[model samples]
Structures are given as C-alpha cells and as structure tokens.
Target: MTDLCVEVERAPRAALVRLEGDLDKVSAPAFRKCLAGLAEEGCVEVVVDTAGLAFCDSSGLWVLVEHQRTLSGMGGTLQLTGVHGVLRRVLEVTGLRPLFASQL
Candidate 1:
C-alpha cells in the first residue's frame, strides 16, 4: 500500500492540503497533526484537495469531521475539492456531504 502523503501550501487566507495515497488508521494521525499545526498558525480556512487521494477509511473520515468542527468553532471553514470515486461515495453514504462547502 502507498503511504499517505499530505502536502500543504499555506496562503494568507487559507491553507491548501493536497492529499495523496491512502488515509487510514496509520496515517490519520499525521493528517490531524498537519491540520492542528495549521490551526495553531492561525489558519482559519482550509481547502483539502483530494484529487490524488486513493483511499479513506473511517478513521480518516473521523479526523476530517473533527477538523471541520474545530475550524467552525474558530469561525473558519473546511472545504473539499476534487473528491470522486470511493471518497465521494463514502461521504455521500455517510451523510457527511453537507458538512463541507459545495463549491469546488
């Protein structure tokens, strides 16, 4: 299995996290840590680009849900883009689609 890799580019208003490979139990902590670091840096808006993400298990989804809650509490937002295939179906099936902004 390909190891999960998260590439982050911080902008003045938002942080873009491009995810690649599988986001599962082993890699969820890394993903959470990246988001936490961004939050500590006063990043309010986060855009997760999932174009290259190959897989996402429940643990990964849990991290994302928690992150969204955290960002929302800080008066920020988490948006997702390039979600398709299994990831898209997962969101839809889990009724988590409405949690993220629809645009992009």
Candidate 2:
C-alpha cells in the first residue's frame, strides 16, 4: 500500500496541490481533507500536480470529480497537471480527460 502525500502552496485565491504515491481507498480521506481545507480557505483556483502520483483508483477519481464540480459551482476552477501513464489512460477511457483543465 503506497501512502499518499499531499503538499499545498497557497497564494491569494489560488492553490497548488502536489500529490504523490497512491490515491486509493485508504489514502483518499487524507486527500479529501486537504482539498476541503483549501476550499475552506477560499481557494477559488486549484491546480493539482499529479507528476509524482504513482497510482489512482475509482475512489480517487471520484474525489477529484467531486471537488471539480464543487469548485466550478462556486465559480472556481480545478485543473490537473503532469498527467501521464495509467492515470492518463484512465481519464481518457472514462471520457473524463476533457472534464479537467490540463496545464501540461
């Protein structure tokens, strides 16, 4: 089980979150908490850097989608960067690749 690590850099209304390791059932809670904190801090623009992300599961995807919708509804945005390998394929297969703004 790869533990997920989340690091955030905040700036005004924007934030950048760096994710590493596996984002699965066990680690999703931590990731969710991190995002929730950012939202509560009034971060309107979020950029998730998945360059160090090793693996991601359905639960992880759900979290991402949930936050994306929440941010969009609040007139905010959530984008992803450094997407590649299996994660990229998963997004593509699910037709969710287009849902996020890719900064790569």
Candidate 3:
C-alpha cells in the first residue's frame, strides 16, 4: 500500500505527469482529479511517466482509459512512458496497450 505521489509539469498545451507508488482504488480518485484539473486548464496532450510506479489495479487502469478517451475526444493525446512489470503485462493481457499514443 505505497502511497501515490504525483508530480506534474505543464507546457503550453501539453503536460507531463510523473506517477510514483501504487495506483489502486484508493488513489484513483486523486489521479482522476489531477487529470481533470489539467483538462480544465485546456491541456491537450498529456504524457504520463510511470517509471516510479510500483503497482496498478483495475481501478487505476479504468482511470487511465477514461482519461485517454476524454483526451482523444477532444483531439488530444495520452501517451505513456517507463512502462514495465505488472502494468506492462496487464496492458498487454487486456489488449489495451494500443490505446495510448505512445509507450515505452
């Protein structure tokens, strides 16, 4: 139950969010709120860096998918970087890897 830590860096129309620790049902709400704040600020492109992420549950995945859909609908994009371990496997197993604009 590692606490989630989020760090965001904003650009003109894009943002880079670095996520650390576990992303589960408990932390999804905070993550969702962070993304919603970016959207409200008119951010179009979002890059999520998960190098420090230790775990992710279904609730976390759902939040990501939801935000990806939202950004896509607005002609924006959501990309992921530093994917590995369980998160990588989950995305692959769920066939949801292609949903993001980029991955690494």
Judging by lDDT against the true structure, name the best candidate: 3
Candidate 2: worst-modelled 10 consecutive residues by lDDT = 95-104
Q: Which pairs clash in the backbone of model 1?
A: none
lDDT of 3 by residue, 1-104 (tens): 99999999999889999999999999999999999999889897999999999999999999999999999999999999999989999999999999997765
- Residue 100 of model 1, lDDT score: 90
Residues 1-104 of candidate 2 have per-residue lDDT tens digits of 78998999999999999999999999998898889889999997999999999999999999999999989998999999999777898999999988898864
Better of 1 and 2 by TM-score: 2
lDDT (CA) per prediction = 0.90, 0.91, 0.94
Which TM-score value belongs to model 3?
Answer: 0.98
- Model 3 misplacement above 4 A: none
TM-score of each: 0.95, 0.96, 0.98
Q: How many angstroms is residue 86 displaced in model 2 relative to the true structure, after the best TM-score fit?
A: 1.6
